[model samples]
Target: MPEVRIKKRFSALAGAVLAAALVIAPLTAAGASAAAPVLGTVGTIEAATSDGNHESYWQARYASYNATCYKHSLTESTVHGAVTDGGKTVTLAPFQSSWPGNGWAALIVNSGTSNNVIVKPVAGIAYASPVNNGGQQATVSHWIVCKGTLPTPPSVVTPSLTFTPASCLAAGAIVFGQNVVWSSVKNADGTTTWTASPKAGTVFPANVTTSWTVPDLTKLSIDLEGCRPTQPSADESETVKTTFVCAPPLATITTTTTKTPYDVWDTTLHKWVAGTATSSDVVTTRPLTADEQATCEPEEPELPTTTVDTKPWVDGSWKCGDTTVLQTREVITTVTPTEGEPTVTKTSEQQTRKLTQSEIGTCPLVPGKILSACVGDVPYLSYSVDLPEGFVASSEKPVTITFVNGHGGEDYVVTGQPLSGKLLWPGASDAEPKMWPGWDLVDGQYVETSGNYAWTRLKDVVVKFRVNPEYETTVTYPEATAECANPALTSVTPDDPTDPTDPTGDPTDPSDPAPAPSVTPTPASASTDNTLAITGGTIQLGALGLGALAVLAGVGMTIVSVRRSRKA
Candidate 1:
């Protein structure tokens, strides 16, 4: 039925006038005891609105399809009116067994803002046989008319804020730690923008932006060089200064012992270490003292000495003695007035802090598709992993799965109907072959003789898998009907070619020699004979034999007109 609404200025007057003609009063049975008064009774139900904000009407046109029923004989089972205002609804009393007429029947609703006029189908309509003498099944229809906007309700909210540490992968050097407050607002386009403000003694900028399609957390960083003091180096005035002086009364030789400091190699550190030393002594002549020079003798002869051999018949030689000289000469001394350049050792420092943001929105769950199927009275479930829609998976890790058989999420098998034979998927692969159930695998498929049989018969299989800790999904394979086609035979024993039942004569019988085998190169081009015969080990040339003959001829075999038969 079509419904039409027209706007009217005189809503209050129009509602009252329409109620007299359209509204039907509820009828009570004669002598019916009053338990509770029925709905839609005139004078018992009050009008929803006296000063109407809007006004409209709806009519339901129905007809009986049975031949014996008149067009105006059908009536509505019940009728009720509901008024909605300020998000709250109130239903007026209903009219029962009403609206049986030739023309349109009106059900008035004293409505404000929005109204729903409901009409229910009667239990039965009088009709002739073949329709079962009952009314056809019908559904209740609702007609609504809404105008003036309703008042919106106030939303209740509790303010909350949180701070979380950043992950090791997302953390950076010199990460600033700050006590900040964050607030988020949803935009009309379904995107969310997050703003942050630092508290006392805190420094940094934080931000987050997200939407239904994408989520992004901003990484905040501030350059410390802009506000911090500059690093300093050692002063140049601390460098060491050295000088040398040479002035003495006479030349002198001094003997002294000295230790040389050196560094040793450390194998573990792969570097040199200092503080070890080696000592030695040296001798030289000194100048004569003033008291010893007063008693000194003049002109003493100097002699040299040599090694002498004391053995028999050996000669000894004498030489001049050694001499020493002292003279007025210069002396040298080295001095350092200051220390050398200072070594400045600098150590690196890394400061880091964590960052976290509130969750913005939720992602709609996408259902996974089941890829399992049955082949030849056997079920082979898909062990392959795939990411569902609205999700992205990382390739760094493998997907883990659990297979469940039967119903009610429990494992079950029929006592007498245990499974037989293996479920084979010829070229299919399992991610974890070792973990596969009791089945002997050949290539990638299951072999019939052996199998990891957990269930005798798989009516349904449930697959639960997880791509990672964050994403877990479940999919199901419903009952399947396998196409169990009959297997074809590979080879068959030949029938007696000379038997009377055989139509085609024998080619191996010499009494009636058969024509020579066809020399057609292409086996597909040859006409086939249904008869079968054998001469020695070879059979008569048939569809497949024609190709063999061509191969033999290509190998330089002579083609003969008559074929050989078995010797008697």
Candidate 2:
């Protein structure tokens, strides 16, 4: 029995060895006969959907394995292959997988014959590193199988971009962070580049906030791509724009007018001609023009008035008759005899008798004609005589006497007027005998009397006068002056009163008295005689008290004279 058992065991071992050979020999032969070991006849490998929502399946086939096949299972296998779906090549890798034949084979039964067969077909086969066996070790054909057709990739909807600051930013303005939001981003290639508009080669995060130094205030754009990076596109968000300004520099201005005289006399005109004096001669209490008034500035004051007198013959007169007879004669004559006397004279014989006319001639004769004495060193002619009754001297008559004093000193007298208020001699009308001459007297004084008078009647008249030594009078005037508050900023110039354009009008006009001119002192010629005198009846005097006068009645009247000195 041991021998018979040994034989059967040997036969069984041999049969088992033969079956192992049958399984191993062809694989070895197939490996030797074929060019390379290949997982062939790959049925299909596909992703469930293009939306990344469904799973992927890989179906593959291996060459026939005759002997009973062994199975090996695989977990987490990565399958990679280029699949054409709708003419577009798409690559995929398996993330997970399962296998019922332990990743090796599947069982099958022949329908016609009652034969059970073990077949190794690569249906539902799981793969790991499908190309080169994950490291150049394995070779396999790959195909994708899907329940439905693969969908297209979603359109690349570019993200919207925006800048913080608007246009025209000032210098040193802070640049804030930017906002980048996505509308849609579906890239089959799994790689893309995001870029800024206007070719801002700045890098940014995929889907997050980003920041960059603004090189300058300018327009910008943004771009997105799955294949490669590109410049900003027109489809990017709205553009940006800004400005800057500096403070204006401070400005300064200055204005000025020339300074000129206030009052002056024109010597060539000979009259009291008005001319511009120095600015010092102007007296400005208030502004004259609106422009000046706005400044509220004061000007220089005016000069004071200096007065002079030129009357002559003080308290002296020309006598035409003797002291006794001159009083008795009704009207005196130019020629009189001093040798004859009106009273009877006693004869040498001592007889108390009326002396004969011849004897009277021998007696002492009363003085008849006498010449009036001259007063000052200035030469002046004088005449006096008794007047006739019926043809009386008109009180208004003006005597024309040449100024022998050589300086225009000839003066006339008006009768029947006060010395301080005499009507001017040679009055305006000849018919009015009482009217005196107006302004015909020189130096505003009469030759005879230092008193004012009116021409009341025609009668005897006595006068004496002299002329002024100088051509023009120099007067001292008072004035007020002002200073500018800020000389560096502005300066004030005194106004001229003598200017014809002076809107203040004439100072002498009672209706509009101009402000006084400022005082500018200057040296002048000295006066020969400081005292003035008059010998006529009445003399009208000025504020300076230099005047003469004359008085006349039906009959001739004696002349009166007076002398006065000017105030120092």
Candidate 3:
């Protein structure tokens, strides 16, 4: 039993050693595959394995697909393999190989113990390993032949555009446009580049319609054979094109005028006053001609007067020579010619005549007394009367007449005179005097009259004279002066028959015969004496003496009378 156990243990040990060998072989091969290989083209040899194997051998057989494989110009090559000792580990390599022309290449690996091997191509057919084992030998095939080159990039066409007005033909009207002409372009890669058209400096015709089109283009660049061809090779067989629309142009113009509305004024009324006419109030349809404007002139207004005091004098007063007279005269004068008359003439035969003195006296004089009569009643008389200085005469030609009382009255009559035409008074002419009532007599004693005058009577006058004529005039006489005359005295006696001391029987005694028992001085007789004296004596003296006696009698009557007897 111990021998049996020992034998079994030995068998187990052998199996263990074999299994260890199997695992270690694949691990070692995987480690070796992890290292990168040196790449080379088919038919070219390069060291690929750390054991010094050539890459061309692998690529020429399995990498190249048994037939010779040439390098592809623009693609990569790859290869795949597994371990030789029945392991699951695989190895792979990528190769970047280039050739001058297009061709085919292949890679190959040896099948160990008749196991199958696989190869895969990478970027280029450089070299490859067996698919199942690392210890297997592999080879590649390379065949060289001329393949077609890649196509060149298509050319880009530059488009064109323009604008024109479709509606009005004016300068600033809205406008539309059409595609314009442009150049085409070419690219290096096989790709198409499109470009939009530009519109700078391009003008379309006025009022025209058109369209745009893009034509099919040819391949613009040359191939290795220097042959130009149309686009869309055997791989792509379609054509490209485009279309566009066009636009129109517009029109232009301007405007003007000749006149304005603010230049006219109206003058319809005869005068220029407020509310008559104003510049803005007048409207003019057209401009006035120079002649029409020049002919316009304003009219004049009529003169006005008041009837109350139209003449030169305030009343009928005239400024005659210093004295005025209530005289009348027929004046001879030429009149102002009327409208349309040629000349006025004076009448040859006594046009007017002076009033006779008798005619003047016919008008009753004012009832007041005469205060002054500077100009006497006479014909053809002119004199400056002596009137109180600074006294305004009722009339410049004043005829002063102070009445008995202080009342003043006047009756003046003036007529146009013959020769000198009534001797034009200071403020009067040959014109008739305009008379007003009410005299404006200020402080003064007299008035004077001037002008030709004549007097008919001089009654109860003070003094009168005529100047310039040196004519004698008469005045009424005044009363004469008187002297005092004395008269005889008469006596009164009392008679009695039985007297004691009587001889001839004269009853009244001369003295003290009988103190006639208190006879009252008969008031009647005293009053008679006063009357006689008042009537007979000088008026001034009798009045004074009587006045004194009256005063003494009144005082004495107030006192008591005392009588005394004399002892004889």
Candidate 4:
């Protein structure tokens, strides 16, 4: 609303005095045409206004100016003034304004005056005029007196609530708690009213009635809604019952189970080894029932078909509980009665036989022998010896056997005597070979030893032979012969050895074997960054040759693999 400035027509002296009295312009009734308002009864008040918005204070004088209202309908009266509740006093010092036909009444308190008044006039507070001979005089009955000091209202601090997540329950629930302390004020009627004013970062709980258990503490916050009760109740001191609901904790738990097969005690290895059969599974949340647990257990193994002492196989049990695994196992032994059994006494046997060419075995082929290094292979021989008549080899008395061989040549030689028993071979020079024991065949493989006799399980019986690798030009290996014998047990049959020939040629033809791939050694040059030392040769393949070497190595490995597969 725009402020309406009312101008009072006064003499120059009176205007100067009014201006000196009040800094702000004074308000008056517009177009009154009557003498200035005569000051009526006056009194001072120390009071405050209690409007719906907020409280406001005032300390000012009230007086009756006795001005006539231009419009006098009780509902539309545009005349107003400040007075007591019954219109006893009114004053124009704290002035007012009125529009003749606009039906709006306003009071403008002098902010700069010495009266010490601060008031915002309540809107729509209008007064009716009294009947008179000329016009109705606006009375002061409609004006409300600003009275009685409003005592300083007590400060009410509302309790607050904060939520913090925590593990409050035992494995099943998630929860939170509240902390509050209510303040109260005693009313004149001997009744106590509880109130709260929440601070920042807090929320007042809504008036709810759902209840839940919080394990940490007992007391909970209840909103009684200040002076107003949520329900109709005559008792003012009873505590109100309120409740709230918390969301349930949600989670997904999983479990995985694995079963291993039972182990068997190996008599020869003397250790446990995994068996061939078992069952397993993985599960989540779903626990096995009694029948499922029984059905999933490993079945008992059948008895062994032996009438001797033996260890029984123990089958273990396994099952999945709710998010847990359970297993059990036990071992037992069994013994059989032994009374009427025939104990056969065995005896040792020394026999002599000639070993055939096939029994002596062929030497293995050497592949990719580009170097002049010595190489040897322990051939797989058949050590099948026959027993003497009417006597059998048993666990108590096994047969004793041995093998021997001798070799010699002009250019190269293996000149060891049969059964001299020393680890010696012809040197690089033309010296006689020293006595040498053949390799022992232990666990189906030949192992070198310094003994005159050979294990009965030995595969081959032959003299150790060597070839002179000092030939000036590329040369083929020459044919040679040797004799092998056993003085105490057996001798080797001297079958004529077949001359080695290339599969595509005649045996007697004097042609060189295929020239093996050769690499002539050369000093590495200063510019070469990559060098590989391979028997008598330093390959200078530069930087890019690393990749080339990798490719060639792969090709060589593939060729060797193909050759082995063909031999197999």
Relative to the true structure, candidate 1 reaches a TM of 0.15
Instruction: Please tell me which model should have the higher TM-score, number 3 or number 4.
Output: 4
Q: What lDDT score goes with residue 334 in model 2? A: 22
For residues 1-568, write the lDDT of model 4, one tens digit per residue.
Answer: 2322233343344445545533322223333455333223222222223331111221222212221111111112222433422332233222233332221222222111211122333333322222112222323222322322222334433343332322222222322233333455655654344444444455555663223222333222132122122332221111111111111111122222223433444555343445654333332233434543343324423211111111222223311111222322222222212344433332222323332222122111111211111111111111112222222223332322112222222232233222111221222111112111333334433345544332311222222211111101111111111111111122212242222212221111112122222321111112221111112223322332222222221011000010110000
Rank order by lDDT, top first? Answer: 1, 4, 3, 2
> What residue runs in model 4 are displaced by over 4 Å at the alpha carbon?
1-120, 123-159, 162-165, 168-568
Compared to the true structure, candidate 4 yields what TM-score? 0.16
TM per candidate comes to 0.15, 0.13, 0.14, 0.16
User: Please, what are the lDDT tens digits per residue for candidate 2 over residues 367-459?
Assistant: 111111111111011222222112222353322221122223343432332111111122222221111211123332322222232221122
lDDT of 3 by residue, 392-416 (tens): 3234333432111111323233322
- Deviation from native of the Cα of residue 383 in model 2, angstroms: 98
How does model 2 fare in lDDT?
Answer: 0.23
The most accurate candidate by lDDT is 1
Candidate 2 residue 285 Cα shift, in angstroms, is 26
Stretches > 4 Å off in candidate 3: 1-102, 111-126, 131-293, 300-568
Better of 1 and 2 by lDDT: 1
Please report the candidate that would top TM-score against the real structure: 4
Deviating ranges (above 4 Å) for candidate 1: 1-365, 375-379, 382-392, 396-398, 405-451, 469-481, 484-568
